[model samples]
Target: MSTSSPEHAIDRMEDRLARLPLRERKKLRTRRAIQDHALRLFAAQGYDETTVEQIAAAAEISPSTFFRYFPTKEDVVITDEYDPIMAEAIREQPAELPPIDALRAMLREILPQLFETDLDALKTRLRITAEVPALRGRTFEGMRATFTVLSEAFAERTGRAPDDPDVEAFSWAVLGVLQAALYRLLDGKTTYEDLPAQIDHNLRFLAQGCPL
Candidate 1:
């Protein structure tokens, strides 16, 4: 339901870029260029078959430069700018709303805009991540990182310690439902356009005590 187009997303990205110091803006641009070239290479070739050297060549950077941007080939597939954005969005949700409701609201607001920004790259990343064992293993690390982000944001909003047992449980529960929905998308059971609805449904299930 957001009429936000890719152009709108690009304009927003440009605005954000303009606010960064020149050096930081250059670094961010380089990082994005590397990721774009890497994803294209991954899509053209297979994930495993696409060498780091090849991606560097495509991006017109050295392999060492590629490593400076992404530590590993798998990192190119897994790393993204979305986590901090999501964390901020989580914190900005209506204070009166419960944590799960806030998260649901944030996803509803952000995901469509995000999808519009780079749906093709996201689809390629998800497909490659699903089909590759190394990427799958790497994602557990990413999941843990995401859990920390969610927990910290929830803690800030709710005035709880980030490490509090209740906060930890709630964050992991949200991660679980999100992971399940991602699996559905990777399995072709859901389209990108429908993914937010699927995530909303899953979160609603969790909010209802997760009855069997």
Candidate 2:
């Protein structure tokens, strides 16, 4: 059984914040507060019915402050803190490891911490993203941004340009596997406890040249 808990996640986040400068830590705290309140409002009132003003009020911030952190309601739903963390973790992997192997290792280390952070909020975010038309349309934009982060990390490790065809292909392929896993979870075909393993399996398949 999973040993993850919300309290542990909060502790982990606090530990991370303890390392940052005061201003940056405050900014991150506010950002997390806004997102947390937004997700709660979205889940309770429905995404279309939950106004930015309401979310801002719930978060104890002004609507302008909301815009400062998230440009739009859609951004509030789709954006996350994971991409930068993933980029850094990928870069920190052993230089001798291949891109796919490095990704697998990074994900193995990161996914459990992520799942522990706030699985319920994560599920609500994914559900809203899947159900809302505006958010669904914006999913590709999010995917593009993630792809760029992944491609740049891979390029830096391999000494190639971010836009190189091989880098782009490998990055997009990883995204595809991740998207498939998310869809399965959203469809109730798999539990969150199994998601990391599923992702790892697909990455292994990709590493094996996707044999039939």
lDDT of each: 0.85, 0.86
- TM-score, prediction 2: 0.88
Model 1: lDDT to the true structure? 0.85
1-212 per-residue lDDT for model 2 (tens digits): 23767687567656655765678667767777899999999888899999999999998889999999999999998988667667777888999999999999988877887787767889899899879888878987889889999999999999999999989999999999888888898789998899999999989999998899
Q: Best candidate, lDDT-wise? A: 2
TM-score of each: 0.88, 0.88
* Candidate 1 lDDT tens digits, 149-181: 899999998899999999999999999999999
Q: What TM-score does candidate 1 get on C-alpha atoms? A: 0.88
